[model samples]
Structures are given as C-alpha cells and as structure tokens.
Target: MKISARSVAATLRDPGAWRIVLLHGEDAGLIRERATQAAQVITPDLDDPFRVAILGRDAHDRMVEECTALSLVGGRRVVWVREGRDGLTGLVKECLATRTDTLLIIEAPGLESRSKLRALLEKAKDCAVIACYPEEGRALEASIRQMLSEQGVQIDPDALSWFAERASPDRAATRAEVEKLFLFAGQGGRLTHEDVQACIGDAASVSLEDAAFAAMVGDRTGADLAIERAMNTDRMNPIGAARALLSHIHRLRRVRLAMDAGQGRAEAMSALWPQVFFKRTEAFGRAVAIWSADALMQAAVWTQQLELACKQTGSPDIVLCKRHVARLAAQARIMARQR
Candidate 1:
C-alpha cells in the first residue's frame, strides 16, 4: 500500500506485515532513520551481525539471492539497497515478485510523478514508496515548532520563524539545526531568536551569507574575506559556492529591475521570481541604497561574465572559484562607490 512519510513512522511502529519496503527521499536523514527502524524490527537483537546486509546496484543480484536463502543464524534478515537507481529497478521488481520473507529496503533520489519504479511500488501489495521534498516557509516553521515542543522546549513565534528561515533546504540539516537549538536551550528555558542565530547557523552558512551580503553592499574587502574564509574552511565545494553567489546576484538584479519600474521595495522584493531570505533584507537594503538601476544592470552583466569565465576556464576548480570571487568583489566595490 502507498504511504506518506508521516505514515511511515506509525506504520514502522509495527512492521510485521511489511516484508519488502522502499524508503526513498532527498532527505538522507529520514531515509536512513526509516531504514534503521525497519532493520531493527526485522532483527530485534542488535548484536547479530548477519541480520543486516547493506548493498548497492553492483551486488543487487547476489544480495537478493542471499536474502531469499534460508536463514542460517538469524530469525529475520534485512537487505538495504543504498543508492539504487534505474539500473537496478528491474532487479528490485524481480526480487519483490519472488516474495522473499527477508525485508528489502531500497533508497534513492526523489522520483517524478510518472516514474516507473514509483508506479511499481505503488501497485505492489507488500511494497511502499515515500517521497521527500525540500521544506520552506510555513511548512518549515511548523516542523521546527513541532520538534521543539516534542523536546519539552518552548520558543516564541518570532524565534520559530527565525529558525525556519535559516534552516537548511533538506531534512537532515533541519533536524541537526533543531537538535542544536534544543541542546542550546537546555534546562527548560525558552529559546530566543538570538539563541537560534547563535547555535543554529553554521560557520559555512555564515560565510556564504557574508559573501552574498558583501557583494550586495559593494564591500570588496569584506566580500574577499568572506570568500577566503569559505574556501579555507574546505567544507564547501568551490563550484557550489560560485553557483550560490550567482543565484544571489540574480535575485538582486530581479529585485532592482522591479523597483526601477516604479515599484516599492516591498513590492519589488515580493515580486522576486526566486525565493529570498529574511536574512538578506539588510544586505539588499544596503545594495538598493548604494546602487542605481543602471548600476545593478551593469552588475548583472558582470555576473554573467564571471559565470562564463568560471565555466570556460581550464584552471583548477579552486583557482577558477577564487578568480571569480575576486572579480565579483572588485565589481561590487566599484558599483558601491558609483552609487
């Protein structure tokens, strides 16, 4: 039967009927959690090493064969297929058709509406599919509030919105952020916006935020420092950082254009095609003050040029990234002064 993630928690509370289940989501944390719970149900004794068999596409056939084989030393066995994709979908279908008593758990990236694998799971009697999408806005806020309440912690509405605004795009990151907030609020104290800001936001996020803010406010030195810190940390990929910065610049350009057409800041910001963050409000405001409509238009041109350079350059990823950040910093400073 088909089920949602919310249902998975309750259905997994008693997994006696589910022999072959698939847990797939963009949220690695949720997928891993559900997989662990299903594995535990199949094997209550955690010490038994043979109770769990984790495999990938390459060993799909062998793992399914082993699961179907007679149990040698354990009452139940679980075969978890990680990163299973289209290549192994046929193998999964074959295994499910054969009806193995051992539980089969498959995890993959999110599937679309017409996905064959998704359809297969939906149609199967003993199989199930779970989808995970990025959480934001009200959905994210509600999740944070629920998590905090469950932990016996209380947070005001403003603080809850703050946490949600800064939360990561995926469930794993969100869960980690909430857990950090809970720990920070320890001993029955109400969590405040400051507390959320202090503990929930990581150095990497802060650095990225700073880089974006610096670019918006036309601060070459600050932008350079932020990019340098981000690169030196080695936690974020250079290519990923460039893409994020480009996205920010694009958002700013859009907002600027709308305002140029006689729209107010609130309307222009609201009319932005891409999503904007509350954290960006101050930086965006600074940018509007320091740059004219023409300046922002030119900034957009520079942004595109940097994008092309980064893409075309044969240099190493790090070097390419550094060059782009430096160029952007210089451009931002020039534009800020022009305004």
Candidate 2:
C-alpha cells in the first residue's frame, strides 16, 4: 500500500511480502537511495548477474519477460526497473499479477497525483508505494543525525543545527556534506560546532547564522557586524532575517523550558532542532542560566512583532530590523550582567 520515506527502512525488513515496490518522489536522490536499499534487501550482491536483473534503457518489455522467468541461480530473484515512467504501467501490472519469485523494484521521478504506476501500486494488496518528498526543519535534521550515527559519528548539537540549516534539499548533497564532516572529524572523533563553521561556511548564509548566534549570546558588536554583512553583502531581506531570528529564539525558548522542567542543560539543548552550536555550548549554558524561560518567551514575541513590522506599510523596514536586533543584543547584555 502507501508508505512514507520515514518508514521505508522498516518496510525493507520483510520486503518479500511485497511483489512490486514503487519508489517515486520529487527528490530523485532519495528515490535512488531507497531503491538501492531495497535492492540490497532482496539480494546481498548488487552486481550478481543471475539473481538480479537490471533493466536497461527502453527495456520495459524485457523487464516483464525477466520478472516471469525462473531464476537460473536458484534463490529469490530481483527484477529492478530503473528510470521508471508511465510507459511501463502495462508491463508492471502484468508482472505483478503473474510473477511470484521476482521482487520488482521501480525507481521513478516525480509522479503526479493521478500517475497510473503510482496509483496501481497503491491500490495493489501485494505492492508498496513510497513517497519521497523533500524533508525540511527537524525532520531533515533527524535524518542527518541518524545517517551520521549509523557511521559511528556523533555531531555536536550546535554544529549539527548549523550544518542542518545549511544542508541542501538534495539527499545526495546532504550526504556529501555529512561525509565531509565525517572525514574532517576522523574515525571515532566527535564533530564540534567549530568544525561545521570551518567546513560548511562557503555560502553567504553563514553570516545569518552568525548573526542569530551573536544575538542570542549578547554580542552586540558581533551581531551588528554580521547583520550588516548579511544585508549589504548577501542582500538578504529584512523580513527573511527577522524570520530566521525568530526561529532561533523560539528554539531557545523550547530548550529553556525543557531545562526548567528538570532536564539537564546538555539534555535540553540537544533536544532542540538546529541545536545549540558546539562552540557556543558554554555560552549557551550561560544564556540558559542568565535568562529564564519567561524571558525567552518574551523574546520570541518581540521577534515576531519585528517580523510583522518589516512586512507592514510605511515603516522603514531596514531601520526597524536594525533597532529590533539591537534591542535583542541589549537584552542579552543585561541578562548576562545580572547573572
């Protein structure tokens, strides 16, 4: 039936139950990735000539023929259909209804809501349809963490957040960035917040992350400089900046409340998405100590107000943004002193 990207791994545990499996989505990389994983589940060696039959270009007819044939090497056979399209619908239907031994796996590009192949797989009792939409926010972050954790690599929560924020929607690109971080961290070594900044900051968005972090920690001068660089050099809109800032404040509020509810500092911070930066770990500890959950709640409200102001008529948006950020910086300084 219908499955989700999150549940693909679990479904692969007993893939023999499904006669045909369709993997389709807007993110081609994730489609290929899941297809490969499913292939491995069917057969240990991907290049095994007899057990696996990989359909080449314009080989839909051959795919149908292969699916119905008995395996020469004698074990469970895998008939993989790559670069799948609507043209293969008839053949897929024939193979699914008739073939018993061969596990049919199809990898296709984005499918419409009414796609014949997708619809057929969804309706079939012995078939599965996996939707691979591009992941965002905490879902993407959790996926990144799980992948890295599988490799025995532990990313610092702050560094993880920073890297996740900059990660591309393409699963291939996301995996490449994580691989780079793994290489930089070396075997069994932990990846820190500084490692993320050092390895993943070529893009201009680093300045925005810097501004957000600076604003959170009461570094007035650093926040102002980062804001200027982000706006003037990167041409980021005031509204965009305000929204990003608000998101960070909201996370801080969540972390602060977690700590207030008896969670340890490290435990609370690690639970947040776009986690507290590793280099800022000690500073974050200080922040949570100095500012109560109520203060962070108030900051979120103020930041939301600032975002609305930037979108309002007749307001000098840039000046309003600057003043609002300055106020946040001032509040941080006050809280730090009172501690």
Candidate 3:
C-alpha cells in the first residue's frame, strides 16, 4: 500500500499489518525521521541496542540474512537500511515476499511513478511505501503553523512568512528551524517577526541567497563573508559548496540576460526558477539592477575557475574557499563601481 509521510501516525497505529516499510524521499533528513519513527513502533525500546540493526547499501546480503533469522533476544527486531539504493532492491523484494516477524525499514532516494522499488512495495500485499516530498508554499506554511501550535506558541502572520522565507527547501530543516524558534520563544510565548529575525540566524536559505546576491551586486566583502560562514558554520562539504556557488552564478547570469531582453523583475525571477523564498525575488530584482549581462557572464567564468581551484589545488579547503570568495567579492565591488 502507498502512503504519504503525513499519514505516518495513522499507519503506525496499526503496525501489525505492515511487515515491510519503504520510506523514500529526496530529503535525507525527513526520510530518516520517518524511518526512525516507524522503527520505534516495531522496536519500542530502540535504546536496547541489540533490537535495532542499522545497515547501509553495501550490506545487502547480510541484511537479508539477518532479517530472515529469528531474533535470539526475542523482542521485535527492526532492520533499518540507510541509503539502500545501489543494489539492495532485489533482496528487499525477496524479504517482503516471505513474511517474517521482523520489520524491514528501507530508506532510499526519491522514486518516480515507474520506479521498480516503489512499484514492488506498492503492489505487495504486506508492504507499505511512504513518499515524503519537500513541503512548499501553503503546505509548508501550514506545517510550520501546526508545529508551533503543538508547542503552545502562537506566531504572527509576518513571522510565519519570515520563517518560511528563511527555512531550507526541505521539511526536516524547516522543522528544525521552527523548533529553534520555539525554544527561542520560551515554549509558550507568542513569536513575532522581530523574534524570528533575532533568533532564526541566516539559515541555509539566506546564506545561499546572500552569497548569490553579493556575487551579482559585486559586493565582494558580503559574498566572501557569506561563503566563509556557510563553509565554517554550516559545515557545508567543499565540493557541495563549490557546486552551489557555481549554480547560483549561472542562475544570476540567466536572470541578467532575461532582464536585458526587457523582462520585468518578476519575469526575470521566474526565468531563474528560484526555490520558495521571498528573498529569491528580491535577489532577482537586485541582480537585475546591479549586474549587466556582460558582468553576469564574467561571474560564470569565475565560478568555473573557483571550482577547478578547489578540486585540483592541494591547499586546505578552508583557505582555498576563502581565497575564491574574496576574489569574487572584489570582482563584484569593481563591477558595481564601473556601473
């Protein structure tokens, strides 16, 4: 049977029916959260250590063997396979075919309509497949409201928009941000927009947004600071940070080109295809005002050079990143002056 992540509470109420549970999504954090919750239903005392067997994609055959064997300790056994996408599908299908007292929890990346793993579990009699997509717009706003309401904290409408704008594009990160806000508000107080601004930090949303904005506006200092902060504070992997910077530069280039073609700010933003955030529109507008088509094209070239330096240079990642960000920021400042 197919289930949505939101229906997990209902599904867990009657856990005896589902022997095999497949939780899949692009968001690693949400997939893990649901998997953990579902596992707890089977192995109520997850801290028992012996009852929970955590496996990864490489341990496919061992996972099958362990699941097939009856638990020596005799309480319910939960086998959680994390990132089990590489080659574990066949084994999971086999385990599902033969019902056992053991509960199998498989967590994989997002699945399409014709996905083999999704189809296998959806068609199976004793299996349940749960799809957890990133929450956006009204769905995301409602989720934030519900989380706050449950914590006995009331949030103003503007505060909600601030939270939404600052939240990451994934549900788990959004929940974490809301929880942080809840704690900041002392559990029972009303959360205002000012409170959000004071406590929410820059979030990954603003870090990426600001970095992109700084690059477009030729504000090297701001860009460098954003990148350095993201690398050190957020612990963003070096390769991933490089990729995000490149992608942002490319996006700003596209926006600038569209603006040159007489597109309005909103139209240029739409062309950039930014994620759900008010600052994305703001950034698009800023990019339009500050960057010429030629400058954006030049920024793209700089992004490629930075990517190569980070990957090929033997220097420490932090130093390499700092140098690149500083250079980008300086270029941005020069561009702004030229205009």
Per TM-score, the best of the predicted structures is 2
lDDT of 3 by residue, 73-155 (tens): 88778888877663566887678666578888888866656677778788877788877777776677787899899999999
Best by lDDT: 2
lDDT of 1 by residue, 206-267 (tens): 68778877866767778778877887775676666766676776677777777778888888
Structure candidate 3, residue pairs in collision? 218-332, 218-333, 220-329
Worst 10-residue lDDT window, candidate 1: 271-280
Model 2, 176-234: lDDT tens per residue? 88888778777787887777778866534667777877877888899888887887855
Q: Which residue ranges in model 1 land beyond 4 Å of their true spot?
A: 1-19, 25-27, 38-103, 108-119, 133-149, 153-181, 187-200, 219-232, 236-241, 260-263, 267-280, 289-294, 310-339
Q: lDDT of candidate 3 vs native?
A: 0.72
CA RMSD (A), model 1: 5.3
State TM-scores per candidate.
0.66, 0.66, 0.60
lDDT of each: 0.71, 0.81, 0.72
Model 2 lDDT vs. the true structure? 0.81
